[model samples]
Target: MSAKRPVRRATPLRKPVAGTPAWVMPVAVVAGIAVLIAAFWVIHWYTTPLPPKPLSQDTTTVVVSMMTGLPASEFDAVGQGTANNLIKPVSGTKLLGSTGKPEVFYLGAEYCPFCAAERWPLIIALSRFGTFTGLQTTTSSSTDVYPNTMTFTFRKAQYTSQYIDFRAVETTDRDQNPLQTPSTSEQKLVSQYNIAGSIPFVDFANQYVFTGATYSPDTITGMSWQAVAGTLQQPDSTQAKAIIGSANLITAAVCKITGDQPATVCASATIQNLEKTLK
Candidate 1:
């Protein structure tokens, strides 16, 4: 009887709402931003152009340059001093004493820091052999000690590649990747010179090998090729003596091979006296 007045079903209760969270909007915004950023990165990676890979290490490239001759100040200072180190080559001896072509073999990479320094002296020395064409003096690697550096000069000139051959074995191509992975001949050449597996190894007529500068990499600290190059123009300066010293050693080795034709400064009494020890 009292019965059925019934069992009214209790309505489902709603969760009590605490005050709207103060950080809700901020947290949602942050998550949305994170998603957008990730999406952007993926899109950029897919859209951006990737660096190219080299064809082969054996491939040869024409050496080019825009710098014609040593500047006046450099000519007078570094050039003259460096030239003094060169002794007159023996009357009949050819550039490469015995084996291999009479080539100026260059081993270096675009990313090298020392190569950044050594290239100037090399350019100055090689200019004596022939004119460099289509050479661009660009900066070293971005991931290297330096960042996006300045441009190097590029121009074309003529020379006798027969007697004074310029075999530039870029160990790595422009993209900072290994290019010419030193052949048996190259390895042998480097070992004979007592140089480490590093760049900017210059072989003059196959007789001399210049490893790196006397001073450490900290010597001419710069963030670009321009800064590094600018330092080379003053090779004879007091601050540059260490570099000049190393350059002299290279010049001496080159001169000895080239019959001292370039009149390198390493041929000077100071450097020659030092060479006497090697002999």
Candidate 2:
């Protein structure tokens, strides 16, 4: 009687769906391939962006030699061709530096095309007063305007000089990821001077400030490192005119901070003339 009272209830089985739709698998496969391809691109971007690749000795040699070796004639010839008015004064600013010397503070990112253009002259100008080591070569962000412009990155770089102190920061890599951090004081200068949040922000000891490219990135947009370096020696080349010209102008700004010292550079007829234009 107990057993009969405990009669088990039958469990109902759910009906199974019919054969899978033919389009489902193919669509899924295509979607999976798309995802893989996208992931590949994200992970395997073309240029080596981070931990910047050190410039080749040959490249460095050429860069140093060409940048440093340029006859003052080339600079005199270029004579601030297109850099006119690119650098402007930031008034009522305190001079920033260390060790009884004026500091040249530079802020830029590797992805910045304007910064890319500006670095050429900055380096050339700095090289005249000092020496740079650990310089790395890279291109601007491939997706940015005037994309893939061959240039140098200041990350992992060092500048030494008796005339002045050089401070540079590559705030981000080509991927737009943080790479270097500027000092709190440097950030203060940036905040004060860089209202536009632009790249290639250069402060010549807070006396003169340049906020953008002195010349167009297009000047060397399609050129390779070697091509850019080679063309720089050509006084008639547009690249030289823009880059070297800008260097001459920048050199003049630095001279003001240095009290027109190193008569070799500050005394040069071209630099002296450009210095007059700084104000």
Candidate 3:
């Protein structure tokens, strides 16, 4: 009679502990380092500040200096034909402002790359005849061609001149959102003269129409606000050749509409030469 010996439960097998492969530890370390690097990159991308959304105080000062101080002699040297391809002559009823002065109407959107480029010469040219207050710095649309092109915006700006009246319509913002709507008269002008239905259109007293930028925006691409403004001082620089050259032509156009008033400006040998070539 034998009492069956208590069956002993088989000992549970323990997890086999083989020596760790030399490659496994290095692989684990490398994988861990890669994860840390990825995390750091994501953090840096989200935290890094983008280019200043608006002009800083220092940048504004530079802009003011450049716009107000570009030498007339330098602009003359840049010469004509830079804007000839951009501006066209149109003879119709005269366009006058509220003050009975000839009006220079500019219709454009901040998002427009051409508008961005045109504004440089436009501001420099207008500054010759008058002063601008409340000018703000901005960039063109990030999604548009020539994205992020730097320039000034006239949204909160005002211009005063004894020679002529300047009117700017920043129809849309840098994001292509409507910033300033065009007036009924402005709309009519757009429909009438802007046959191309494009932005950055300029109607100089209804005597001349500028359909697009006078020069390639590429000239100033990747330039900082300060750099672009500073280039106006250097006549030999390509930026000056494009920006100041266009300005000279615009000055000539405005002089024609103003009856060549402010003789100091229109009488300049360079402007006079450009005036003769104006179509």
Candidate 4:
């Protein structure tokens, strides 16, 4: 009976698939790893907090320094005419508002490099007489000239001052998309004074109008917000010279409109000297 068992046939080994190679398995594994890595990066990019976009701690410190007045010696070195080339005097216009306070109207787009450059001194000058709430850190248009220039946006900001009323209209966002549209009065002012239709237009109680930036945008092109702000405390730095100089001129103009209400600011010898140079 033991010898009666039939010999079992050896099962034939299966052949490899006709066209598939052994390397296919490793290639598939590598592709899967790459996909996973890309997904992680995409998630991180969306989740991370970026610098100078939403008012970081460092940005806040810099803003505070700007709001605080600089040393008298610093203003002296920069001189009064630093912004003379960009500022123009306008006369024979009605008061901006019925609030019985002098009004400073700023019309600009977030995408404008000129606006970006001008905002620095404007913030500094205005801060001397008032406090700003809800200021946001932003940059100029990435596609426009002097792209990504660090600056602040007044889009959500409110300025409170005993001497003046600050009105800001950010016409477009950083992407050149529509943001805040100008009102009828604002449009009329622009049409009548901003003959070139350029941005960064500022009307200082109809006494002075700044058609463009006080300094060239190139001054702060390659610098970070911190770097530019740090230089503000340095009187000799080119950044300080331009920024502070422009601030002094703007301060002088504002004082003229305010009749030097706050003696602490308008009475400063530096500001008094700067006032003499105003047209």
**Largest lDDT belongs to which candidate?**
3
Candidate 2 per-residue C-alpha lDDT over 130-208 given as tens digits, one digit per residue, 9 for 90 to 100: 8998787888887788888888887888888999998888989987998889888788888888888787889988888
Worst 10 contiguous positions by lDDT, candidate 4: 48-57
| TM-score-sorted candidate list, best first | 3, 2, 4, 1
Candidate 1 least-lDDT 10 residues = 55-64
Residue 257 of model 4 has an lDDT of 88
Residue 173 accuracy (lDDT) in model 2 = 90
The clash numbers for all candidates, in the given order, read 29, 0, 0, 0
The TM-score leader among the candidates is 3
Q: In model 2, how large is the Cα lDDT of residue 275?
A: 87
lDDT of 1 by residue, 5-115 (tens): 667899999998889789999999999999999999898778643322321212212212222243434433442242223221222223342335466667777667666
Cα lDDT of model 3 by residue, 8-113, tens digit: 8999999989998899999999999999999998987786435457777676866777767877678777876355456779878999987889999999998899
List the candidates' TM-scores in order.
0.53, 0.79, 0.80, 0.76
Off by over 4 Å in 1: 1-68, 71-76, 79-101, 147-163, 191-195, 214-249, 262-279
- Candidate 4, superposed: residue stretches over 4 Å from native: 1-53, 57-62, 66-69, 81-84
